[model samples]
Target chain A: MSAISIQQIVKTFPGKHSVVALDHVDLLVESGELFGIIGPDGAGKTTLFRIIATLLLADEGTATLRGMDVVRDYKKIRKVIGYMPGKFSLYQDLTVEENIQFFATLFLTSLEENYDLIKDIYVQLEPFKDRKAGKLSGGMKQKLALCCALIHRPDVLLLDEPTTGVDPVSRKEFWEMLGRLKTSGMTIVVSTPYMDEAVLCDRIALMQTGKILQTDTPQGIIDSYALQLLAIGGDHLYDTLQLLRHFEGTANCFAFGDKLHLSLKDNSYSAASVTAYLEKNGRTDTTVEPIQPGIEDCFMAYL
Target chain B: MRVLLFLLVKEFQQIFRNPAIIRIIFIMPAVQLLVLPLAADYEVKNVYITVVDNDHSSYSHALVNKLVASDYFVLTGYADSYAQAMLDIEQDRSDLIIEIPGQFERTLVREDKATVSIAANAVNGAKGGIGASYAASLIQDFNTDIRTDWLQLPRYNPYPVIAITGSNWYNLHMRYDLFMVPGILVILLTMVGSFLASINIVYEKEVGTIEQINVSPIRKYQFILGKLIPFWIIGFVVLTIGLVISRVAYGIIPEGSFGLIYLFAAVYLLAFLGIGLLLSTYADTQQQAMFISFFLMMIFILMGGLYTSIDSMPEWAQVIAHLNPVTYFIEVMRMVVMKGSTFADIRSQFFIISGMAVFFNVWAVLNYRKRN
Candidate 1:
């Protein structure tokens, strides 16, 4: 059985005009699996996580964690789930040690009882354990928040965009920590807007406008993009792109870094033929190469 | 219950670790309780006066002697004219002036009653009134003495049949501090618990820390309770310190049970914590929270009878005071401390505070939205 099963969940907020934050969203997380929700800002990632965490009730549909209904068994689910929110939500006035100990105590446990589970991250905060949580550096505060979330030895961990504002090094370190936690047979569901981080997850769901567009393994999604893609570059790249759009059999072309990534209806067109055509149209120093579709490419294809 | 205990401990740690908060929580109360009361008294003393004795007779000298004999007034300067006395009044060097007419003793002998003019500055109305009354009484006493000596009759004491037996309960001297200390402690506790609690939580929301706690398994109630319990305890500790200072500095002790006072304080603290929670739900920034709480606190304290008697206010205001938890707490505290009332004596106030606590908690929990 899946550790978490969300079936056609829907939530709407009442206002002058109703805001449809979640619409018929469904997800399933297997035990001991690392799942990721990939989307940009306002994509309902946090809303979905909150509903599953039992922090909010879905306006429609059923969500269950380990066979316990989110709404009916909220108190029971609270004990088994560890959630780290998108923002740093620890008590600012409390010290680092105080924050962790408070969370542990809330769960009817002590820090010593679950020290082994969080010791790796908690140890780094030992020097500044007495400092107010508000005064800690961003990275230290992040670590402390994660430690507090994990201090209760929860079964399912829900991290809502945990690395949104941290430095790259801290971001990388945080993922590594998640990986270590995953090996301990804990189910992890994380959300992020960074496509690069999508590759680190065992599986990912691409979401947009409160709807899940696709859910699959990162490689599976990329492998499923059947169109031939080519990276094209030349002088007057803008002019080249305009000319390429008018070319026969051209499907789609958009700027990708320093090169233009193009999808074509036919693969029979030769690179020399494209270069000759660009040169004929007053372009120079053009280069073209065939490239494999990445997760970003797959995301663009869906968009 | 375990969660509450953990949260309380965490709060104590936060309050105790910071030296600034420690100073505010512990030392500030002592200063307010000890020093502010002594400075706040309205009892008048050490009055200064300038005498323009036009007669310069033994009779005028005798009247001046009577005035100087009283501790209330001291002869500061001898003014040559009314203009000089006006200078003394403007400079605050003297509060009163006595102008004795020429031939004062001869006029009194012929007219039976001679007019002695007295001018006083009435800027501080209460003080001015007291000083004027003292001067009038002194002159009247002298006139009566002269009448008695001239007539060769025993002194006629008016109101001889009337007797006043004065007794000050709880506070024998009615030290202003005794009346003020408990009220000050109540205000401090409300400021620390409600004002600070709301600011702490709302600050997290403003800084985006609330999002972190929201995603955690920590329930919303747990988070709020965790934030409030520490402040509540700190407020109580501050109250205890204030109480000790009142005892040491003002020699005022509770006439009622100390345990009962603390019990009422705990209920009042919970109501205050609920108010803080409700404020957190409404505010998004610390400054906004502080200002809003400060405004509401002002209203609560004004109607709470911290400075004035609520009974003296309009009936509508008295009804509003019934809804104010601070009002009941202050009333209950004063009764226990000053009147030495037992539990049964304050049951009505206890019921009102208990009802308010329940109402505030429900309101706080209901108004607190998890998703926004």
Candidate 2:
């Protein structure tokens, strides 16, 4: 059975300034597959997540979790899905253990029943089980929320922007935990604005303005770039980018770190040819190389 | 049911964890019941009056003496002219000025009628109105006294006067505290019950923990019941503490069945807590719930006949008081405490509040959408 499937779900918020939050959005995640919804803020990623979690009703379509309709069979859907909202939503006044137990009881399960699933995370939080969740640092709060979300032994987990605001160390640990969870065969659908994290997903759908721009494996998306690209670095990186955008042969020129990812109008322009052109324009110190596209390169190409 | 029990446990843990809230739960009812009744007096007294006796006649003096004699009015001064009376009023020594017209006694003997003008400071309308009515009743008594004293006319028997012979059955002393304590207790219960339900849930909503709960498979009614049961139980604990304090400090005991009061109180709290839950369901923030509950509590207390008699209010206000749940609770309390009224005597109140309980709880639960 497919772990999650959404069919042309449309949702619009009615207000003084009516916003079409979701517009004919659709997706299907295979069982046990780790899928990522990559988008910036207000890209309707959260809206789609909430609908799939059965917390919100779609205005115009249907979603199903493991064959249970999100609208018609929402109760069963709720039992089978673990949803961690975009916001840190654990009770701040509650102790860490209490929050876990509460969420466990909500699913008619117990911590002992699902310890194996959350052992790695809960073990780190054990010393502070007596401490209130609010007093925990950002990383600890994230871990507690994750534990609570997983305590029910859910068949699927929906994590919306779980690592949006965390230190680099914590972000790495969070993905590692996700990697372990993925291996356990529980379907995971997580969203993040970080394009670098997109490569970690088995497959990702790039979303913007309530639309999925593309859905593919990271390498597949990178390999599908049709234009020949060159990475160019020079003595003056900013000046090179300015000249490259207006260059007659330049199709796309954007700064990627210390260099520029430049796609040329002509596939015949080699690194030597571009270097010779920049050299004539007083950018004498330049290094140019043909390079493969990263997920960011593909994302900027689509944008 | 297990989910409900867990939710209830969570609510209690959160409430008990806050020492200040727990302190208030136990202490507030006791303090309010003990302190509020002493100052919440409805019977007006000590209305200061300045009499301008321009007639200077025996009848005018008799009227002045009558005003002085009634405990309701204090004779602040006697002036020969209206200007002096106005001066007395300006000085704030008197709230009212009684101007007996010239030849006040001759007119009564010859024409058989006399007019006395009463002017009162109406800035504080409620106080001023009560004072004026008290003075009017005193003067009416004096007129009757004169007819019996010196007129020598055979008492008219066109309609026999029926003295009310009002027996203030249970509270024979008519202590304001006895009447007000029970009403004040109901007010406190409503405020605590509604505020607890509204603010507690709204706090969760504001902090977004409610979102976590909303996404769960919990039934809507179960969620509402769990939220309400904690505060509902606390409300009754307060009622029990309030009753004990009322008995010990004020010597009040219910003449009616204790079981009936408890039953009515349970239903009253159910209805009130439902109102609180409904408010919170519509509110997305703690501040909004608090202000809305506060506004409703104010209306309930002021119109529920806690410190004011519903009968004395205008017709429209009386109809509104009839609809207010707090008013029914206060009335039932008075009937049970003061009149020893049985449940049979207050079946309407019981049915009305039970209906309210069902209506409000259903409304609250329906409005609380798990799939928001």
Candidate 3:
């Protein structure tokens, strides 16, 4: 059985107009794999994480961690699964050492018993052992929260947007820590809105609104793009974009940083033809080239 | 048990780390205890009076002197007309106005009849009601004095007068502090117990820390007890501080056994702390918890019969008072302190409060949901 399996899970928040936070979602994570759920804000990533963590009940269908039902065997699941909420949930008044000790004790284990599992992350936090969790920098707080979550040496870990709101350098280091934890025979399911981070996961599910648009390895997703993609760059990029939108055989065109990524409908479009077309529209200094698509390009394609 | 121990440690660490909480725990009790009983004095004194003496005779002057000497009334000023004295009442300068008629002792000597009208500002009901009765009784004494002086004294006079001598029980000197301090201590204990406990869990919810607790392996009862035990200990600490202050500062020692008061306070804290925790579960934010706790505290303190007698309340109000956990605690506190009542005296109150404690705590624990 997979470490975590969710089948036809549906959750809706009640209101005058009910919001479907999770609409028939299904997921499977193999043991010892780093899986990521990639989506933007309001994409229901936190709601899904909360459901699998057993903090919430799905409106329909069932979810299980290690083949134990989330609703019926919640007590058994709680023992083996560690959840770090999207928000920084540690007590701000507690010292770093105290926070680790508190969560460890709650899981019926001590830091000393599972010190090896969290030693790497806790090492960075040790210098600030006496510092209150609230007074730490954003990076340090995330690291401390990670240490608290991992101190119990659980079989599965669920982190919701752990690296969000951190400096780029700290975010990179946080992913590296998760990479190491992935190899420790623990099923790690994490979520992030940063599309670039999708490449670091073993597999990723691209989510939009409340539905998963596509789920595959980053390379597999890029390889599955059927349209011919071309990058168009020149002066007056906004005007270039508007001009390209009316161009014949143009399937879809959107700005990607400094270049406009243009896909063709069929063999009727070519790079030379696009360049000639732009120059015909009073655009002389223009560059058109076919480049490999990244995870973001695939995500945009899926959108 | 170990999980509860660690939870308590974490709670105490957090409580002591916040400087504001430390200051509140110690300073609030001292300030409220020192100020509340003194300000909430029931015995009204220094009642400002405006006397409109239309009679310029010695009888009117003598009545005014009696009022001045009684220590209860402070003669603000003597007004020339009844309308002038009415201004004093309207301006809140005087609580009562006495209008002496122009009989000038003639009505008393000739026909043994006279009249004096009293107008009191009933805005402050206690001061006005008590002050008016004091003035009327003083005038009655003056009337008897005049009649005695006018009549030929018979050494063995034959009018049978029923004289009733009464002894004040529980409080010989009728010290208001003796009556008020213990009840105020109950309020202090209630504030520390209920208000603090109510806001504790909700604050965690606001800060998102409750999500961590919800996802953990801790049992529901263990979590509830963890939140409760710390405040339960704080309740005793506040009670101890109040008792010490009452004994040293106000010179009030419980006439009954200290064991009985502590026993009652222990159960009382559990009942209301359970209420505070129950409120905590229902509220999503600390502000909501605080407002709901404030509403309940107002009802508990007001209907608890601290300031007014439960016996004097309306039938419906009396029912609410009996239903209130605070009413029983206040009654027991007064009984133990003022009347020196033993366990046997307050046994029914003890059982009722114990029942309330069980009911509130069981309800609170069952209502607190880890998943929701």
Candidate 4:
């Protein structure tokens, strides 16, 4: 059985006119996979996470974790799942040791009991145990939050945008820590708006506007791209982008770094035809190459 | 129980760690309790009087001396005419005008009858009413003395009569502080209890920490009790400190059972704190909770019978006072402190407050859900 399975879950927020926050969403995470739910803001990602964590009720259909019904087995699920919300929410006035100890004791466990589970992260936090959680740097606060969530040694962890606002170095360290945890055989589900982090997950579900656009392994998602993509590099990248958009067979074209990635309406269009067309249009020193799709390319294709 | 213990430890740490909150909860109430009672006195005193003695007789002068000696009135001046006395009162110079008529001593000795007109500035009605009564009683005492001296004549017969006496119970000197301080302390305690409890949960909700607790295995009642218990203990500590100050500053002590007074206070705090928590649940921000608490606090304190006697209130207002938990505590304080009342004496108040405690706390707990 899947560790977490969801089917046709629907959620709406009441307002002047009701807002459908989640429209017929479905997801499944196997026993021990680092699954990423990739979406921009307002995509049913948070709504889905909240439902699976038993913090909210779906307006329709059902979801379960380890074969326990979410609605009926809420108490049991609360014991098994660790949830870290999007914001830095640990008590600002509390010292780091106190916050971790509080969450540990809340789960009817002690810090000493889970020392092995959180010791690596706590090593960085140990020296500053007396400092208030709010007084810590952004990276330290992020680590402390992760430690508190993990103190109970939960079987499944749900992290909502954990590294949304952190230095690049800290974000790298955070992901490395998650990688270690996954290797130790704990199932984790994380959500982020950054498309680059999709490759870090074992599997990913791309979501937009309350709908799941696609779900697959990161490599599979890139390989499944149906459009013939070409990266054309030359002088004046912006000018090349506008020139490519005016091409008769161009389906979509956008600037990517120093080049413009262009896809055609027909896969039969030759790369030499594109090079000849660019040279005729006063472009110089142009290099054209067929490229395999990245996750962002796949996401843009789906859009 | 273990979960509750840890939550309590966390709560107490947060509460004590903020030096501003500690100062607000600890130092401010004690100082206000010490100083507010003396400043909030409402006893009738120093009634300024202008004597308009038209006759200028020995009897009139004697009555004026008696009024001055009673210490209730200060004779500011003897007006030459009633118009002068009216001007004095209108100008806020005097509160009462005692006008001695022309017949003065002649009518009293010959006809055994006389009349005097006393005009009072009734803008401050309590002072006016009290001052007029004091002057009337003193003049009557002087008349009786004159009759006694007249009876010393050889053939005069002593009249058989009845005299009435009164005793002021609970407060013999009618010290307003003894009555007011306990009531004000109840207001202060209620303000502290409800304000702190109201802000507690909303603060967590605003900071997003409540979402963490919401997803935990902590029971709903455990979470609420964990939040309220810290403030519940603080409320009692505040009361104990207030009571000690009441004793040291005003020489006031509970005349009834000390155990009974504390029992009533505990129940009262429970009711106010529960309402505060209920407000917190309905508010998404601390500012919203503060406004809602302020709105409720206004109604609770005004209808609480702290300053005015409930018995004197309008029929509807008195009916509303029955619903206020603060009213019961204030009444219990007076009954226990001044009247030396026992449990049986305040049995009705006890039952009502116990019912309020159960109603408010159960309502608060029931509305508090672990899920959004």
lDDT of each: 0.84, 0.88, 0.90, 0.88
Each candidate's clash count: 3, 0, 0, 0
Model 2 clash pairs?
A: none
Among these predictions, the greatest DockQ belongs to 3
User: Per-candidate DockQ versus the true complex?
Assistant: 0.36, 0.67, 0.91, 0.70
Best by TM-score: 3
For model 4 chain B, the run of ten residues with the poorest summed lDDT:
B152-161
Question: Which sequence of candidate numbers ranks them by DockQ, best first?
Answer: 3, 4, 2, 1
Candidate 2 vs 3: which has more DockQ: 3
| Candidate 3, residue B279: how far the Cα is off, in Å | 0.4
In model 4, where do residues sit more than 4 Å from their true spots? Answer: A230-248, A255-261, A268-292, B46-164
Number of the top candidate by lDDT? Answer: 3
Candidate 4 per-residue C-alpha lDDT over B1-372 given as tens digits, one digit per residue, 9 for 90 to 100: 989988898999998888878887878778788787777777777999998898888988888888898878898899999998999999999999999988788888789989988888999998999888878888889888887788766464566678797878889888988888888888877987789888988999999899889888999988988988898888888888888888988899888988998888888888888888888878989999988888888988789988778899999998899988889889988889999999898999988988987898888888887787
By the DockQ metric, which is better: model 2 or model 4? 4
TM-score of 2: 0.89
Q: Grade the docking of candidate 2.
A: medium
Off by over 4 Å in 2: A232-240, A270-289, B51-70, B74-80, B100-117, B133-167, B311-318
Provide TM-scores for the models.
0.79, 0.89, 0.98, 0.88
